[model samples]
Target: MSLINRLLLLLLACAAPLPATPSDLPLKVGLIGLDTSHVIAFTGLLNDKDNPSHVPGATVTAAYRGGSVDIPASINRVRGFTTTLTEKYGVRIYEDIAKMCEEVDAILLTSLDGRTHLEQVRPVLAAGKPVFIDKPVAGSLKDAVKIFQLAEDAGVPCFSSSSLRWYPGVVEVATADFGELRAALSYGPATSEPHHPSLFWYGIHAAEALFTVMGPGCQSVVATESSGAIVVTGKWNNERIGTLHGIRDGKTSFKVTAFGTKAIVEQKSGGNYAPMLREIVKFFQTGKPPVPAKLTLELYAFMEAADESVRQGGTPISIPDYLRRHGQTR
Candidate 1:
């Protein structure tokens, strides 16, 4: 070979990229929805090392652009968020969800439309990948129950939650030594979506916060509408009472007040996505869900029962009956 040709070949070899060592690479995460801002927020937090709140260990490598056509909020923003994920984060957009699942270690179902989550996550569970479904796990309580069952049958780790559950104050109050917890009240903005049951859209955040301090076992629920807000009262099997105010009139914010035998603590601030992302990464890495499926089922049942109360003209609705309608024994 000519001397100049040999030198050119050596230069090419020097410029080649190095293969990533196993430990040097992060866990691959795929997104199943692009309609919500979470697509960009979560991707940046995971992929951008320079980010101040960056959560290490998992990186979003692929996403499927799934959006609901009937929902304007969903379909309209899908393209914009999809572009941001592709251009800014260098995330590969896949047209097929199953194909995307094959390429990633875990999945984030962040679709804005609750009605579409069950269908969107079907492929991810089938691929045996752990998945995190965002707020309002499903369009209905029935679908939510089916989702957990499906995930269990598939032997895939799956969890769904609202970021509000981790609000610093909420966490503090929940874990505080408030001897013999009595009852709690959580209030937040609850914008309704025609396609979903009341509280499934925005009120879910407050519902989650309520359950965080209250801890399931809610036996009955009743809802009353007044001054542009829906007020829900729940009776726990322990004889503890919890109330939720889905604010719709004005000045909406997230606040949780826990009453106990010793003290009354409140969380008056909003939530951040970073904390939830950290938990998601930990779950993806450990293959264990932070939130229990049974607890989640009860939470959804509580919300659905509130809706049922409204439909029955403020009659108290039994939580167990709500779950039973979905064929859940609990």
Candidate 2:
């Protein structure tokens, strides 16, 4: 080749756009449910460029309007939120989840009703997409266990968690340099849903925060109810005690008090969803769950055991026996 031609070729190669790097290409994300306000908050954070708290690694490109008619909370606001997703954020709506899965790289199972999560996630797992299930992984413990097993069998990464787990204060309580954590107390609003256990709905926030401070090995759970709240006490493996107070009446908020050998600290401040969204984005990018499936299953088991305790008149329920009865050895 002539020198001039070679120089021209080199210039063109240099000027041509480099193949997009992984960091340059954002992952395409799909939403499985539109009933909850999380759809709006999450979409705005992920899709709206002007939003102050926008998370940049992924964009919500598609969604499925999955709502339960039996639950007023699920059915009433789904339409409005669906409209907002389409009109405000320009996200495509898919009537079928599998089809949406075909288009997006990852799935966010945000359905307000936990019962639908198992069935909805089946198609997502079939497509081999990484999924992040919102709180209450399933309506029941058995279903939650099965969901994780299915994802594991499929070799697809999956996880479920409450945003409170990543709250600044909660993280501090969980990871501070204080002497070993001896006990913890987490309290928050836990309104009961007739379809779900009392703690599965809103109380998962506090429950998750509790587990954050005291990493999972709850051997026993006992719950008692009063007019004001339903209190659950858990015994960890190392004799570390953790308590979750599910407020039923009057003013309610999330707080965690950690009792360490060196000092005691309480987190009364609140946080927004942005921190958790960042973790979700990172999980989608890496195809790794921020929270392990086994740990999440154990958390659900803890909540289910609380229900069993109430059923047995506040008798302490054994976590191992509870998991074995539900066909979950792990």
Highest TM-score among the candidates is held by which one? 2
- How many residue pairs clash in all the candidates, one count each? 0, 0
- The 0-to-1 C-alpha lDDT of every candidate, in the order given, reads 0.89, 0.90
Off by over 4 Å in 1: 1-24
Model 2, 173-250: lDDT tens digits are 788766988999999998888999878999899999999999979899999987789999999998999999999898
lDDT of 1 by residue, 50-141 (tens): 99989999999999888889989999999899888889888998999999888889999999888888888888888999999998899999
Where is the poorest 10-residue window by lDDT in model 2?
321-330
- Write down the TM-score of every candidate: 0.92, 0.94
Clashes of 2: 0
In terms of lDDT, the best-performing candidate is: 2
RMSD (CA, Å), candidate 1 to true, equals 4.8
